[model samples]
Target: MAQPQPIPGTTIFDGIQAAKGYALNKMCFSFNDAGNRAAFKADEEGYMARFQLTAPQAEAIRKRDVLGLLAAGGNVYYLAKFAGILGLDVQDLGAAQTGMSKQDFKAMLVRANEQVIH
Candidate 1:
């Protein structure tokens, strides 16, 4: 059998990633609560310490590096909560993931939608 080709510029969220990101995901999930979001904003370092995040995960969070967080095994679903805490939305993440400016990313989305609709 031929070996499967991995998708370029994509991280497969498999068992290894799940295991590696358990702590980070858990911390992000906590952001679903308004109080938790406020707490994180008030004491970023202390909140991350409370979650016992790995060094890379903590650093990614500190830097607001969406791609780095994904590379460090963060699930986009969970990370959305974290993003919301930082006043970001899915469009911001999409732009970051594609390395496009927000305006360009939105334009691309419109173009793609037009293709599908027409």
Candidate 2:
């Protein structure tokens, strides 16, 4: 099978990327449990260390930058779980990705949906 061509400024969540992101993904998945989320909030460093995240992944989590996390091998689905802990939703991440305010990104979503509907 041919490998998918890499997109500029994008991280493709291929098998290799998934392997690299395992620890980060595991940590994010733990957020599905409210107790784990509370534990992470109680001591972020301890939680990160428990997952053995790579340095870049740790930094991305610290900054709460969705793009950085994606670049560091985070899957969007898993990151969404993590974002919930920070009171952020996927729309916030979308806004950050597009360099727009949350309002603008939400508006873009609405426009796209309207186009599809019409």
Best by TM-score: 2
Instruction: Give the lowest summed-lDDT range of ten residues in model 1.
Output: 1-10
The sequence of per-residue lDDT tens digits that candidate 1 reaches over residues 1-118 is 6644777887778778999999999999998888999999999999999989999999999899999999888999999999998888999998998899989999999999999999
Cα error of candidate 1 at position 97, Å? 0.6
In model 1, which regions exceed 4 Å deviation? 1-4
Residue 102, candidate 1: C-alpha displacement in angstroms = 1.0
Model 2: per-residue lDDT, tens digit, 1-118? Answer: 8879977767788888898899999999999999999999999999999999999999999999899898888899999999999899999988887789999999999999999999
Indicate the TM-score of model 1.
0.91
